[model samples]
Target: MMKQKEAALEFAKLASDWEWRLNNLYYITDKEGRVIKFQMNTAQRELFKNMHLRNIILKARQLGFTTFIMIFMLDACLFRKNTRCGVIAHNQDDAKRLFREKAKFAYDLLPDFLKQMVGAKVDRAGELVFSNGSSLTVGTSFRGGTFRYLHISEFAKICCKYPDRAQEIVTGAFEAVSKDNVIFIESTAEGRTGYFYQYCMDSLNKHRAGMKLTALDWKFHFFPWHMDKAYTLDDPIIVPQRVHDYFEDLALKVGSNFTSTQRRWYAKKEETLGEKIKQEYPSTPEEAFEQSIEGTFYQRQFEDLYRHRRITKVPHSPASCVHTIWDLGVNDSTAIWFVQLVGAQWQVIDYYENEGEGLAFYKDVLDKKKIDLGYTYGTHLGPHDLEVREFSTGKTRKEMAQGLGLFFEVAPKLPVMDGIEAVRGLLPSVMFDQERTADGVAKLQQYRKDWDDKHGVWKDRPCHDHTSHAADSFRYFAICAEWLRDGYSSVVTLPATHQQQIPTGAWT
Candidate 1:
């Protein structure tokens, strides 16, 4: 007795809630690549309910979170008119796969009656247009577009692989979406670094601080492997005694009701993968970030600094003389670290880095800062390279600085590794001004050794990138401190034709 139009309307009404379709109507490829009915697991359900306004998800592997997001976007497009939706994957291949295998497969599995109502075939560019003029496009780049709904899968990977592009996307993508639009950013943790990690932490902090979370700001949702019901095993006899004990301890920590079969699966999986299991199927967010991080040289030392509250708002005391440590670069970047040896500890009051400028510019900047902050200059410390005469000027950089008011005290040339070690020793007593030294702090934390991908090991040398200049400048500071402590002198002599104007004293 059901009319065709009435039946279609009823079905369309049911499709409004994605959870209903996921449980009863949707279809997808199962674990064995067999096409089967899609079912909402425990974690997915929790995630679905929690994804409101702006959502950022940090999820473990094989949880079908990406698929859920894709399907949810598609459902919105089907019923709504002019619903501009998009899904951007980390890489080109992932974008293609999501469009071809998942989105296309889900559409193909739709009932003939429903497919008739939602008219239109997919285009060549992985775009599916509905009868109501709504469209969903999957691609690697979605930087420009007035999108009503957008989901960025593997966002952390994007931040790691393409940092500049990620920055552009972060800056541009949100502004394109309307005020009430939805934007979901989901990814597994790459490391405890990058903007992605900062965004998640900021979201949590804002939520805790009782700020109203809106479409403008993201809300974090962490889904570990234990929350996914399918992660457990059906076989109970295979669990090892060691695995059982480990799971028992972990359960006590996480408050999970551990089953024998779950322990067996983890044991068998762990045999194939030792620590990688934790990285892939993490039990917690913290564990995920800690497990697979590339060996960062100063991470532990910096973390200790953070924990002991050394990295805080340290004001410049007018009573103490402020020292400047410089890494001078003509064509490359120039960096400087401002420090004051306060009583027993070193207070890093400020930091500055700039490129494509002359010595006069830096001098003017220094003069301005001194005037602005009421800082009495102690001495300027630069590398031994300052003594080298430039081809054009026919005078050393050290001579040029003397022409200005900055009398340079040359730091001893030490091996880069030795300087890094000195920095590790100095980190315990270093106090930084959080706002003034933000860039310097980040550079130090991220300064790391070059990774040898082919050899699967860290290279002996440090990675020289944008971070290197700041790190090298700080290294010079460490060298200067060490030399001064060991009774080194500041009276450095270079070639001088006439009477030199360079001043020398306690700065060494």
Candidate 2:
């Protein structure tokens, strides 16, 4: 009985401590006079209150992301005293709304005793002039200034629309702030090649490197659509069926973006309006990418590829010899990829890609690498245009390859659709040996479609110029191998209706 009483007292003391902490923490109230407690989920709450570094809040919608930051800013101004907080949004309207809403809410939530201490009045414009000379200014990228606490909302969109201005804000204004300051940049995923995405990648790298960045300094937050516990597959029965059908068709057509988690989430949200709304605001990186306007390569196939670390080099094998593919470029680049075939798996082993170079220079690289000339392969149709054009040495591409002591086999020519289909079919089946073909594998993974808006189709535009020669060569080899497997005596010809119509200007 004594032990039970002691345990009860301990529990009571712990509860009292928590209550004290909660009471001291700041809260924002809505216009209804009810105190709005920032209730975060496991991830959201953990991230919000984290004092480690400036926070990066990658949030799905309705996660109270903006609200949380606003409260944090308010706490800084009220408690820290003399703190200069700046909120920058994609445009003036966003900045104004965020500042106005947050300031008004916070001002209303202030206790009467604290309200009496309001030294400066809240400007109708949403700028709060505090008594301690600290001020909070809400401005767009156009209005530049130094700040102790800088909040950047929808930074990815801002950077895309105005790259120069975004750079100025990050480098000129935000960087000038003291190290002790907080700069929170939060946004969803843009394409993988944007400034915001690059920054996030760099921050992640820095984090992995054990660099200590404040929550505001270098943070990446991703709130995918699946985190909402209220979401359930039993709810929106039709949504699951529709989503599944869509994914099935999509996978058959373009071959990506239907992750297991995504399917589950889609099903869960189908029944409930809230869950559906949350789907529009993905909470995790994978969800965001899958639902992104450009779509993503995060499905089972991509997952398997990533897991196997397929984008690495292949080890040298005596039985496995290297074969090359060449996409000859004069104005663009001369690309050559070295690949090794081991049983059914193909590995990109090495590469030599460049432009405007003499045949001797290329020959030297080939000799240095000791690549066997017999295994080299190139387009069967040849660099139709480039092959006919005379270089300064007056040698054609065939002559150039010969002069470089490189043996070249003509790659089989197929209809454009056939080539594309071949690549698509081969990608999932190809097992890359990373040790020998790191560069080549990277190119393959990054070989993405050029989204055509007019036709609403994804067209393959050859990419990886720096390392694509080898990839092109490998594709040629794969095409030939596939041809042999199918028992085709010659290149399989598609019907005239399936032939790709090359644009008139494409040659130039």
Candidate 3:
């Protein structure tokens, strides 16, 4: 009787302590298929110690955060009454796997006494409801229920792949959770776009500023691959000079050293991952997003431009004529790029984009540029669709532009893919003013093939997102700039009729 009472007292103490309960009470199957007591690893422990109400984790591949979060949610549901926990994976397969491998598996292997104490009231496909009103649910997205704890796993992939689902999480699942409750949005870096990247950047900025996190503010947590003990190799290979230099530079930036074994492991891993290794096991946050996004049309072109330092200070010359290319949108955004052809080089001087503007507004913009910057305007290239007459006005955009004193020459119609190819060919000889065309340049870099999520393939057409306007305007420039090869004088501002008379040529 005395021994049983003593055991009961110890059990009660362990149950009361969350950390003790996490490690002592739970059992998880490891990657090697060994059922072991769930112990928090270094990265997990560090994250737990500094975790805030709202946390966004940007980490290297497989730090066991998904496992930790699932177990954490399960533990919370078991211990606390009326606790509603939710886990959101990037897809259905991941959601099922997380619930099966972590939550349900650990709960099944729990001590009989503890299991009896907190009996399962409801158990179904993707959820477990405790008798105490605490429950855990895992799915791709959740719509209605409020949650005390919410974990969004592989959010970067969701942002990159299933954008609509990502938005639903932001507007629905995220908003459903209370501000004071725990919410973990964790993922490896995908690219430099989407809400996940934006959130990481915002959190990073706040962290750098040393601002105390409020309930609304997300606390950023970064765990690099080198921090994990399992990342080291037994027989380390010779690290290449370039790889060694990168490691040294990254170490200096992040204030963390990489072991020879870890470096070797990373180098070997790069053999399979190639350009993706940096995204997967990044040494620094900036380095993670530095890689070109997959399926992007201008990825190679942009990479080459950066490599040769072509994107630099491209000052406009008074002697050369400044050309303009435009993508006109009535409801959407109007994008324009100012280019100057000097010998073989296409010097991209400036870019402008605006919404809900008229021909008068754009004409004023041109007049202002002429007066302020002393720009000697050359050929103004418009898309073939510029000749489409408006329903209300019965006037083509070209005619309206001419009336506004902004003369435009209609570019020859070509297939979208052909135009994309033209842009790729033209990009090699292009020099851009980094500061002046920063926004447009960023759009060009992001222009990519539309992903067919259902079929798991990339559609031939470009993704019609915010990047389209700039990309389309640049495509017009690439196609129409062939006319400039004939040496159309910039000093002579040709009349609208003269501009219309310009002959179209076969663009190679």
Candidate 4:
């Protein structure tokens, strides 16, 4: 009877202590499908120690954060009276699976005494209602109820694949929680735009600045794949010298070291993942989103550029004449690039893009740049559609541009794929000014084919987003490069599409 009382006292103490209960009382299915006592891994423990009211986590694939969060919310519901928790997955199937596998499975494995003590009244369809007034719910979105804790899983995928749904969650579900309540937004990166990326960047900036976080402020957390001990391999593999150099540089950047076994694991994984390895198993936050997006037209070429360190601080050489390439957009954005040909290399010195601007504005911009940089102007190349007349002004844009003292040479009209090919061909010889052409480089990195949701495949045409203008301007530059390579005249005269010819003296 004394031993039974002692055991009862120990059980009560464990029940009162949340962390002890998490470690000893709860049961979770391991990755290999074996039920075991819940023990926090390095990543989970680190994240839990620093969690604030609002948090954003950027992580490599399969760090078990989703499972951790599910268990955490379940624990919160069990221990705190009247507490309500919500788990949001990227889709309906994921919601059901997470709830069943993480929450329900663990709950079913609880001791009979604890189960009776908690008195679970409702356990059906992604929800568990306890007799003590706490409840847990899982869904793609929840807008009606107030929640003490909220977790959004795979938010980056939602932002990339379902932008409208992502906005709805931002407006509806996010508003359901109060400012002081706990909210976790976690995901592997998907390109470099959307709410998840923005939140991660903002929180990371605040973290880097060493600013104190408030109830409303988000705390940033990053979990790299190397942090997991299970990521190493027993079998050895040869690491290429270039890859070894990349790892060395990454170590200096992130202040962490990797063993040869880990490097071998990465090397083997890269064989299957190729360019996607960085995105999937990133060592740093910058590398997570810097990789080319899936279906990108210039992924291979951009990888080469990064490998060769071609995207650096390329200085503008006054020895060569600078050329301007443009993609004029009607009712959209106008993108421009300043390039110089020195020997066989193409130096992309500068880039500029603006919306709702006219020829006069661009001309003023060009003139100001010319005076500031002291550049000797060469040919100004534009796409074939530059000659299209607008309703606002009957004259073609080329004529309007010529009127502003900026003459343009029209590039040959080619298929989109052919232009993409031209850009790929020229990328090998191109050197970009990192600071001046940062936005253009980002556009190039993210430029990819449109995804067809219904068909579940990438469409042949490129997705025309903010990136398209810059990419289009570069395509025009590539076409002009081909023309110069073929020994075409560098002079820009009256456009062939212009209705009237200018005097010979206008050439100057």
**Top TM-score prediction, candidate number:** 3
Q: Give per-residue CA lDDT, model 2, range 1-508, as digits (tens).
A: 9998997677557535532323354565544657776444555566655633455556565555666667667666765567888777888888888876766666666666555665456565858877776777777752444577778888766755455567777677677566776777777654333457557666667766887665356665566544555433433333445557856875665445555656666555433433223225553454454443232222344456656666444565567555555666666666666655667666555655567875577667666676554344322223344356484667666766666666455554454445545555555655555433433443444344454443334455643434355445555555555433333344433334444433323222
| All candidates: TM-score | 0.63, 0.48, 0.65, 0.64
Estimate, for each residue in 240-299, the C-alpha lDDT of model 4 and write its tens digit.
776798889988998888788888888877777766677888888888887636778888
The regions of model 3 sitting more than 4 angstroms off are: 292-508
The lDDT of each candidate is 0.77, 0.56, 0.83, 0.82
Could you give the candidate ranking by lDDT, starting with the highest?
A: 3, 4, 1, 2
- Alpha-carbon deviation at 79 in model 2, angstroms: 1.8
TM-score attained by model 3: 0.65
Error of 2 at 502 (Å): 11
- Segments in model 2 whose C-alpha atoms lie over 4 Å from true places: 1-41, 51-54, 142-145, 206-217, 230-265, 268-283, 290-508
Q: Model 1 off-target regions past 4 Å? A: 1-13, 16-18, 206-212, 233-246, 271-273, 292-296, 304-420, 426-508
Against the true structure, what is every candidate's RMSD? Answer: 8.8, 14.3, 11.7, 12.4
Model 2 TM-score (2 dp): 0.48
Clashes of each: 0, 39, 0, 0
Q: Per-residue lDDT for 85 in model 3?
A: 96
